[model samples]
Target: MAEKIDRQEVQHVANLAKLSFDDQALSKITPQLEEIIGLFTDLQKVDTDGVEPMYSPTTEVNVMREDKGIRSNQREALLKNAPDTQDGLIKVPAIIDESEDGDK
Candidate 1:
């Protein structure tokens, strides 16, 4: 037998998600939700006694090399291109107002 989703259950979920649905919309969605639950129930009957679980469907492997300190020596060049710089680092305007309501 397929599981059923009641109107009360749908209303409770909508309340948890801060959603508001009319009676008409609720009536229309209940059967669709029931169909989805029925599909999942059908899936539970599949035979997979010897099947191995896989994280992804594809057989691709990670062939990328490990990252190294390849850009550590480019700090001088990067700082030179900056619009504004402090002692040796880039500088920008304060984004937040620290004086507002003692927020810091």
Candidate 2:
């Protein structure tokens, strides 16, 4: 079993991860962290004499279809489906924050 951790150690770990935890949150998380460490400590005692390590979850076979060239829709027909067009190309509105610019 893992030893009980204090606030200082939890704060240090939070700093290492670039995270911030207030006093109430730290108090709650400390015991949960201790329990997780104890579980890992228990797992360390398991014997695996001849077990092979797994790198992936699945035994993968060819899952993708062969990439082959095919004919596609014509440009003019595609342009006709667009909501707005300019100079034979699709035209979209500017992605600006109008509210930040004092515009309602």
Candidate 3:
């Protein structure tokens, strides 16, 4: 068996992920993480000699819509509902800086 997860290991992982936690939060989180690791350790001991692995718990399938070509005069009506529009398209907030050269 692998070595158990300790408080220092958790703190190291938190530091690597750029997470800052005070002592009280770290104390609370350490045990919860330890319990999770314990659960996984228990799971590793379960017998599965003849069992088929279950990939998904539910039998539900995606109900995909049919891809169809549409011809419409609804462009004007649709743009009416938008909070902002530009060049006949809905204008959403940009996630990145746009260049003056219009390279975006």
Candidate 4:
């Protein structure tokens, strides 16, 4: 069945979406929008009794490995590749904000 839609309702939607369509555009869109709504209404009429609701289309499986602490290379070995380091720590320039106290 074709769903009937009011022109005012479409105009209200257009206003919300910040769209300004002339009379010709409104006339063209109304029937197309009605057809899409009708198709969705028809889809709701299908029987899905006893069928499990699907949260995901694919079958669920865990690919995660067990959490365990493992020994890694020392801090010196990791820092050796850094372009610049100071006092055994990675150094970055301090970012000063002029408006730091304005909001409070």
Each prediction's total of clashing residue pairs, residues at least 3 apart in sequence or on different chains, is: 0, 0, 0, 0
- Which clashing pairs does model 2 show? none
Model 1 over residues 1-104: C-alpha lDDT tens digits? Answer: 66678988889888999998899999998788877887889867888789998779988887988776575788889999999999999999887766785764
Writing each residue's lDDT as its tens digit, candidate 4 over 1-104 gives 55677677789889999997789998999888887887888866778899888888888796988898888858898888887899998876667665786866
lDDT by residue for model 2 (1-104), tens? 45567788889999999999998999899888887877878866779789898878887776887798777868899999999999999999888867678754
Candidate 2 Cα misplacement greater than 4 A, ranges: 1-4, 49-52, 58-104
lDDT (Cα, tens digit) per residue for candidate 3, span 1-104: 54577879888999999997789999899889888878778766778899999999999998988899889989999999999999999999876766644864
lDDT for each candidate structure:
0.85, 0.85, 0.85, 0.81
Candidate 3 vs candidate 4, TM-score winner? 3
Best by TM-score: 2
Off by over 4 Å in 3: 11-20, 68-104
Error of 2 at 88 (Å): 24
Candidate 4, residue 68: lDDT:
89
Ranking by TM-score: 2, 3, 1, 4
Error of 1 at 33 (Å): 1.1
Instruction: Provide the lowest-lDDT 10-residue window in model 4.
Output: 92-101
